[model samples]
Target: MQGEATGGTQTLADLQHWTWVLGRAQQMLLENGIHTMEAAPLSGWSDPSAFARASADFWTDTMKLWQRFLDPDSEGGAGEGEPAEHARDKRFRAPQWRQEPLFDFIRQSYFLIADHILKGVDALPGIDPRQKEQIRFATKSFVDAMSPSNFAATNPLVIERIMETRGENLLKGLQNMLSDMSKGQLTQTDANAFTLGENIAATPGKVVHRTPLYELIHYAPTTPTVAKTPLIIFPPWINRYYILDLSPEKSFVKWAVDQGLSVFVVSWKSADATMGGIGWDDYVEKGQIDAIDTVRNLLKVDSVSVIGYCVAGTALAATLAVLAARGEAAKVASATFFTAQVDFAHSGDLSLFVDDEQLAMIESLNTDGYLDGRFMAATFNLLRGRDLIWSYVTNNYLLGEEYAPFDLLHWNADVTNLPGQWHVDYLRDLYRDNLLVRPGAMRIAGVPIDLSSVKTPAYVQAGREDHIAPPESVWKMTHHLSGPLRFVLAGSGHIAGVVNPPDAQKYQFWTNPGETGSLEAFKVGAKETKGSWWPDWRAWIAAYSGEDVKANGARVPGRGNRKTYGDAPGSYVRQR
Candidate 1:
């Protein structure tokens, strides 16, 4: 099964081959009573009266569906009546579904059964909570897989395309699937449509310094006069740093440079066996601290503004706390955190996967010293299963269609490995222990971290719909910071909320002047503002940036003791 589907040579027959393989696997599971035991909670007719009532209701619905199917004047089989809101979930959005009654009936019936099965499982006598969660997750996956959208035979869009192209599209889709399999993954984007330095991370800059852990990039100043205080950005090492430098129009790095602030970004290396021993302390010392020192030295500034995104922001906060203890806090002018959480108490769904059992399982599987990037990618996809998983599956497998190239999706697929030590420590100390928010709970570079001691003026932003770092979790940062803090809630989920460029002006943001309270209270007091939050952030950071100096255009790639290591979006970003 591994090598059966060769790239470019896959025919429509390959689809049938995979289907047969799946059917055989299902048969094996059924014959072994896997389904019966897994669904034991729902298998028995424990109460005869309730069972009889359910049977009658099922029969009634089936009769109505049959009547609708036979009625010529019926609105093209629109199910007996409109489906409940859950049945009409966006993932099932196919024109034929609502336009054709049979498909609608099939979808509604599937959801109805799914709801009942889940209810029965929840009511089961004395299941372990962890086991119940695992069971429910598995059940949801099974139900989602059985969706009509996941099968060509049941999907009207796929049927129409097959009839139109005489099955060429099917063959193409098979080749696409085979090609992706050969690469040891599924095709999430049109990879051929993108080249790293050529387009995606095309922002102009130079790598000023390089280390085994990261490369420090100095973006060419877009404005003539730059701020006296340079701005250094630390993006999460989980993915490549290019998300901040995606395209010129949407690039946060570019936006800052245009605002007359000298910008430097840290592009982290993809971890491997060689980097398996790297820990959180190494990230702070060699990764963030080293970059900050280099930027300060180059600009000859006593203090610099810093920005951290996601996990990087958490690392930055810890670093600042360490610096403050050492009386070196003067190096920071102000701190800006984007979708970063210092408190893990409200860290959302991601926390569910970090318990002892799951961590132990992950550790056992990651014997090679690093967590595979694909595993991380899959976990995140599960958080938004309908949009990221099922939708792509339906388009590629069921509809036999090629994915159109999308920049953000491409970036999402370009995942990087995580060092085992760093990953384990992060999960245990932060997610499991909630240490960052606790005074003296964590130590970095020989100094204990207390976020409250770090009194740098702060601006914190969180996405209202962020699942990975819930806004409430981010909101807690205000209480921990000793300095004046301003918190803003942006629209959309994690990535989309932050990547929103000003010109695009797509999402709205909320702000409450001088507001300080719990997240719910803040929400009640905040007023909505139209357009990107970038402008608001720009205005806030400007006051701390100091007056702009005359454009020197002096700092190019190979200046001072720091020689240019390479071009912007350098070698580290190009690493697999």
Candidate 2:
């Protein structure tokens, strides 16, 4: 009969009347627990304000009832003719409904409630609930189902305390998330405030070095120190270098100096429209390689033990590969990668954001030659949207809370742009294509990358919770490398995994005996221990340094009367 309505024999007026009735009936059924699940989506509005206005008890009960309805075991987990373990089976059948008198009453009450709303809006005629015992029982059951859970597993008391303290914790969480979205739009840093002058007369023995790309700065050993080979540190370009040298007490660089190790850090140049033409190779050539030349020339050293953190470490690996292919691997004495990705093929959750469609959209807009830093930040925040976006929306907008200005928050806001071609090529080739690990899959400056040829002794760190690069993804690099590899699985995410201070409690890492042939064998031989990997890394790096030198090494000629090349912290950082 419904299919025949298409024919002209069925009058258009009758069809319209049927459509109205059906629509109203659906509204009644959906708004109330009729044939559908015990709980349903809120009607009329779907925004946060509507959610806030909703009765707390009503929502709590609705969620609980929905949870139970979804669990098959709640209905014996099986119907007649179903196997004993049917609930665990993928094709398990649901238990049949009993359709008792109480069910009929709830169905009628649902229609009545929906009718009230429709009539109030002049859409339908309202119905009054009958004073029936079954109807009253159904109504009470519905209310009981929706009421907040008091079970210890649910921890309703703790939840209430958090709600009270955090000011509608859910709402506050949402507001913080929205605020993060807005803050992500801006690409300014409130963390890169310290200037060389601030540290300039503070320590006389400190050697402040500046690179063509970055003002390469460091503290040199004043007294006689072990011939510990010069250690060059590389931090991710996504963030400022100070993350490694955060502060006096937490500074990894300061700790290295105390360990009697000579350290030079490649503080990457902040990118701008001028750097739009620069690609991955250019960063290697003008950035890492350039820093190496400057340090060697100034320190008068033949080779340095290089340490690269996160993205910088990946770049270092590429540079080393390029150098090795050209028979120039002797420049590096040893190498250490901190939570870096040489092979991004196994990058789990992050893989979702780098598909073909997203790559195309990014390339089209990045035609300006650079992928704006803000866009990258926004993309990362979206990965954890519930925490970074919705949480803020609930807090600030719904609950009216003040935003906290944390240093990490400020630093997070400081995003740097990536050159268009380079960024796209990296995603498509390394991430989407998994070319880096494939033998000779990548070419740098006309040089093919063969990890087997890279015989540089290496130390690789993998963060357990790192979303950007998982432990497995980074550990995969060891298979491709021909050299001795020591891979450590560290605690924390991408940032904390690398920037970990020496004394941070609860931090742990696993180190195998030597470069245990493969990642699997490495995991077996691995031993877990507490405390940051900073001290362990420092000890490992110190052993790689050649014996102490008698003569003072190369030194950058002082500018003396010449105008300082650039202002403190320089003009390049502000280009964006």
Candidate 3:
């Protein structure tokens, strides 16, 4: 019944729509630079005979497909039930099943014929590149002009599931698919864009120790109690170090010290061959484990609280696991992970790049043993191609617009390369195989990773909109730990989520460990606290800070008269 109504084009509007559809053949050719200018009108469209022939071929095939449902003489009559099922099944056929190769051959042949016609057009005169750019932009605007809502409704690919159905399931699937795709695109756009503070004052404070993976910097309190417990902060090596204590107004470390906690953060060194051979195990051992020993000896503290951010959290998890398995777990007081993951099974979209074939391709490149950071940045960029790739192409080429200068974009564009070996091992072991979550699945320097033995009180944070490590993937760390655990869910992606400062516009969260039945249940009743999660974390540490003893927390010999680096925004940071 429905098929007959659609087949019979009774209204003028229907005929006009079909006419516009046929016109798309010419428009698509124009987008490819054919017939775009008087000097270079599409060569293919140059010959009236050839253009008419191709137009007939395209329209004929399209009508053939359409007539299966719409043309009264071709299919069902007015009283017949819809042929929706057949159409849907046909549309859903895989690319190969759709004879895509043959379609490609036909498309190429049309292009060849079009080129012959365009040659005649090109002989007329040359067009300025600037004008050509405007033409390109105008052509692209046809596709880009649709508002988000209109695109959702009119996009044929999106509306197809509902097009052939009469039941509730059709609406449900359409709604869900639209919602999912919309969120996916939005997340992709957000991930690739961020704002940066301009003319950021660069001054240095504290001395730093450099390792192959990073440089450890410490800003000790000016007036320290005779003895102060040192807090070592391990930031993810993915970006520059200052994010934690960005400035006096928003400095997380400075806030902690005001609460009387000594602080040290690892300023991850930019990549070079000397760092290329470094892998997860190496980072855990030399990067983290050694740092612990150094801080422990330097400060003479029996134990200290350790905080890890993102990838650094993964490193901390492994380090603690190795320590626990070796029966040497007393050096750490507590552990905190900000959006870190121990299990990769639920990693959401990041999993797209982690399958066997991709890993093999990466292995082929990592044969030199270090994954270049540039390669890692490129892979991440591809994941958000609509914004990161197309937006730039549109602005720089199609629109001929000057690249807008922004600090965050500068930082993003200033991508650093990851060592080949580091990435290969990380992807293969953690993401591809989910090794970290497997019982005794991971080993470092002959030590098996048994996270269940890690009794350090733990705090784990996951971001709600995070694409790199979704909440589901990150929260798994709570399940693996043996100690009382706190899991926090923040609002933004990897960086913004963590850097989230407390404001009415934002909120931070927490609840007592095991105060509720499960992570899900606890989240339901968790208290919402305003402002940066950083301050709350500082308070949490103070509560757990061992009683202030008669002696200072920990004392290092080189503490006083130590040379302070230039100031906030040091020399190396400026170099970037």
* Best-performing candidate as measured by lDDT: 1
Q: How does residue 532 of candidate 3 score in lDDT?
A: 59
Per-residue lDDT of model 3, residues 1-576, tens digit only: 433232322354554454454347454664444344445463334444544455565556445434432454655432134235422432223332123222222222233333333442343234454333434333333333321212322223223323454334345534544643564321112222332222322212444455556656665454445224567888777766666665444456656655666667776666655665777777888889888887776666777789998788988988998888877788888888988988887776566667678888887876555555556666666555545554443333222233454434445544455667787788888877888877778778778887888888887888877778888788778778888776777767776787665533465555544565455776788776655576667666765567553323233223433444534333444322
lDDT by residue (tens digit), candidate 2, 1-576? 312221213343543443344344434533443322225432432343321233333334333333332353674321323234422421111111112222222222333333333332232112122212223333333432322121111222323335456546546545555654676563222234533334311221232455545666545555465454677788787766666655455567767766766666665666656666677777787778777776666666778889888778888988888888877788888999988888886675566557688799988977677787888787776554544544444334444456654444555665677777778887888778988777778887667877778899998888888877888888887887788777788988777777677666658888877646566677787898897887777677656788766324432113222223433234434345
lDDT of 3: 0.58
Q: Report backbone clashes per prediction.
A: 2, 27, 30
Error of 2 at 198 (Å): 6.4
TM-score per candidate, in order?
0.86, 0.65, 0.62
Residue-wise lDDT of candidate 1 within 341-388, one digit each (tens)?
Answer: 888886877887888988898888668888888888889888777678
Residue 519 alpha-carbon offset, candidate 1, angstroms: 1.6
TM for candidate 1 is 0.86
Consecutive 10-residue window with the lowest summed lDDT within model 2: 89-98
